[model samples]
Structures are given as C-alpha cells and as structure tokens.
Target: MENIQHRNINVNGINMHVAEIGEGPVVLFVHGFPELWYTWRHQMLFIASKGYRAIAPDLRGFGDTEAPPSPTSYTAFHIVGDLVCLLDSLGLDKVYLVGHDWGAIISWYLCLFRPDRIKALVNLSVVYNPRNPSVKPVDYMRHVYGDDFYICRFQEIGWEEEFAKVDTKKLLASFYFKRIPNPPLLSKDFAKMFNPPPYTIPSWYTQEDLDYCASKYRSTGFKGPFNYYRCFDLNWELCAAWTGSKIMVPVKFVVGDIDATYNFPTIKEYINRGGFKESVPYLEEVVVMEGVGHFINQEKPIEINNHIYDFITKF
Candidate 1:
C-alpha cells in the first residue's frame, strides 16, 4: 500500500482525490457508500502488478474529495460528470471501469450517458436497475421497503447527528461486518441498531481499517454521504430520457450470496431469469461467491482481482 501514489486533480468543478499505480491500460475503480479509494488498495496493487494502471477516486462527498453542499449535487449526473471530467483531465479517451455498491450504480450511469468512454465494466454488489418512467426511485423503494428502509430514512435530515452520538468505530464496524441477507431497516431508533453486543471483527477487516474509516467519517460527518440517498428521486427525474436504456458496454457482474443487495425482493429472479441480461445486453459473466457479503472485493480480494483481470484482458 505504501508504494501506491495519491494526488488531487481538478475535475468537474471540484478538486478530486485520486489514487494511482502502474502504467498501462487504465482500470478505474469506483467505491460504494461509506468507503474510500483505500477500499481498492488490494486490487489496485494486484492489477498494477499485472500491467494495468489502477485508479480509484474518493467520489464527491466521500474521503478526500470535495463535498458539494447540496443534496441535488450528488445525483448520478454529478457523480458521473465528475468521473468523465476526471478521465478527460487525465488524457484517457477510454478505460475499463469497475465499481461496487453506489460506485456500481454510478458506473451504470457512466455507461448509459457516455458508453463511448468505457472499454468494459466489472460491477459488483449492485446490478443495473432500469428506470421506471412512472415512479420516482425513492417512491418505489418506499412502496417496497417502507419508511424505515435505510434509503428512505436517509432522505430526512439529522442522521449525521444521530450517527455522531454513537461510537464512530463501533458504528462503522457494525456496518462493515454485519452479515444480514435482508435489506437493512433504519427505524426511528436507528442508532440502537449499532448497539449489538460484542461484534467480532471479520477476518477480512481489521481494527485499523475500522479506525481509518471512522476517522474520515468523524472529520467529514455523514451528511455528504447521506446526500447520495437524497438524490434518488432527482436521479430518477433527470434520467427520464434514458428510461429503459440498455447498457451497451461489455460487462461482468459479481456479488456475494449473503449480501443484502443480492437478497432484495425479486433481484435473484431478475439476475437469473434474463432480466439483468436484457438490461445489460453485453454482460459476459455473473459470479456469485458463497459466504461473502456486500464488500465482495475486500472480503475476497484475490478472487475478485482474478475476475476483473480475466474480463478486462479480453478487450
């Protein structure tokens, strides 16, 4: 990790922090919520060793990147714009893309809005959710998961304060290690959810890792990250033109069987019953890793690296 290089560059009207290593074909790694570019440390080094330049940025509102104040600024357009401009600033015309969680979500939009810029993609944890022309995203989520669903709860202000009241390290540990396959619910007493007794740090994650994440969140607060959830409806609205659009880039997707996202109602049916392929017309492979959770890359680094290397090397 010490050999990896970090720097900041101006992109999309904000100074963005980026981590890079090696010098060859570019593989851009986008991380999900509550995660930083550091999340890609293992894969970065592995891919770099294999002759691919690995680039991971702390997306807007996370890590060392500039956090714009408005919730509207966190939409897919804004996030994708940041990336597109980042690539432009770096003098790359096209690159292999890899993302997990919200990063996966943004990678979908990148392919949708600017397929010309992507050579291929490997998205983790989340799949392509086609836009519903008639309903907003948050509305559909509320209808399916109700008000206590984490995304819905994040829409309201003050979650940052609530999260702050709890021990930051423990809170992050609970979020990173919990193995619940069901979608998370954030009730009125959401803070209590992090109070579970005696959490054993998973072998894949260390106390130092937990401390590093907590330190960043404690300094930046959670509002910027929560703002990503706040833009669900807005993204739905702004993306109306691309409704039912199929992602045309060659793609590979991987997920953990135990991940809550994989267990979302009807998601398995969608992925396995041709719905996922229909939306991602060029999807080449799907890998489901047993016993892994949402953090597939971190939990199964070598396997995930092999999956990425195998696919990206094809083009």
Candidate 2:
C-alpha cells in the first residue's frame, strides 16, 4: 500500500476517490463487486514499476465514492458516465483499461458506449455476450436458474437485511476460493449457509487484505454494492439503443477455468465457439487460468498482472 496516492476528484456529480501511482501513460483499473480501488493493489505496484501510471477508482459506490440512494442510479450508463467524467476531470483523453467482475461488466459497457476513450482493454472473469434483442438478461436468468439463483435473490427487496446479520469480513471471506459452484444459489437455510464455522484465509489473500475491504464495507454497508445487481434489468432496458452493437475496442480477456462465471452452462461453449470473439471483434486473446476462481485478480495477482501487461503493451 506504500507509495500509492489517494485523492478525491469530482466526477459525474460525485466525489470519486482514486488510488494512483507511477507517471506515464495511464492504466485505469476498475474493481468489481464488493471490492474497492484497493483491489488492484498488486497490479498498481507491478504495472507502475513497469513504467505506466496505474490508477484505480472505487467506481460509483462500494468504497469512498459517494453512493446514490436509488438503485436506478447505478445503471451502466451512470457507472460508465462516472468513469468517463473521471477521465475528463483528470485531463485524460484515452487510457488503457483493466477490469474484473462487475468492473468487467462496466468495462464492456465502456467499450460499447465509448470505444474512443479506451486504447485497449484487458478484462478478467467475464466473457463478452452479444446483445440479445429478445431476452431481458435478468428475466432470462430467472427462467433458467429459478428464484434460488443469487441474482434472483438479490432482486428481491430486503436482501441486505440478511447481509446485515453477518459480519462483513466473514461474508467476503467465504467467497475467496479456487473454485465456486456454477449457478451459485441461496439455500433456504440462510444462517447456516453464510454463518458457518470460521475458516482460515487463503494464503494468496491475506488477513490484511480482508481487513481493509471489510473496514470499507462496514462503513458503506452492502446495500450500495448490491445495487449493481438491482439495475440488471434497467441496464438491459437502457442499452436497447445499443442492440446488436459489438465492442470496438481492442480487448484481451482472461478467466479461471473453475470460475463460476466460466462454468455457467453455456458460457464456455459460447467463449470457445467463436461467439465471444464475434462480439468482441478486436479480442486479441483469451487465457484460461487453471484452478482459479471468481476473485481472479486478488487470488492470482502475478499471473493477472503478467496477462494485463502482456496485452496492453501491444498497444
């Protein structure tokens, strides 16, 4: 965490907290769900040492960034708008992009909505899905996966009440793993499921890392973080204007073979059958890391940094 500079820059009507280092062409990192700008700590140092300015922001919520009360405010347009405005505020025109999890989703939108602002992108843990004019994304998930699906559960009101029962550290820690079940669902026995016996933190992710994130979440609560899910249908609706659009930015995608998103029944087939590259026409490569999980960046920092550098350097 040393040598990193933190500051708040007003963007998109919010004061966005950014963690930055080095001093060259910018590498703007976007963090994922339940994560902060601090999520990219390792990559910041590594990429900065490699001579590029490394910048990571907490997105619109989930860290020091101000969270709007309405979930409707967390749409793809809103999040992407904040990031774009951040670039403007910082006097940047275009920068290399890196994203993971929700950040990956937002990065996809960033490329789709404003490819002119990105030199190249390296996205982790999510594949680019072609815009389906017929299916509302969340509705499709509910139809196939049922209400027990975590996204469905998140859609229901008061899911955060359940989150409130548990400590934030334990909640985030349960998710750190090498592999997670495909189609992750919430069982009826909620307490037993989330509040099970304590376990040790994985060596790849330290107690300090967990503590840092937990401290942030403890202040903001999980409601704003879950707001990203709350806007799934809205993002789909708003993006109707962009139906059938392909991401124009050059991209390199990486995922863990065991990542839950990777294991989604049709995801692998789609990624392998040329559908992913079809949507992302400029996709430079796809790297499937063995035995990794949803938290790909933090769990495999060196390899992730190597992957990011390998592709971005080409630009």
Model 1: which residue pairs collide? none
TM-score, predicted candidate 1 vs. hidden true structure: 0.98
Give me the runs in candidate 1 sitting further than 4 Å from their true place.
none
Error of 2 at 84 (Å): 0.4
Q: Please identify model 2 stretches exceeding 4 Å from their true place.
A: none
Which run of 10 residues does model 2 get worst, by summed lDDT? 174-183
TM-score of 2: 0.97
**278-306 per-residue lDDT for model 1 (tens digits):** 99999999999999999899999999999
What are the RMSDs of all candidates, in order? 1.0, 1.3
Which candidate's lDDT is highest? Answer: 1
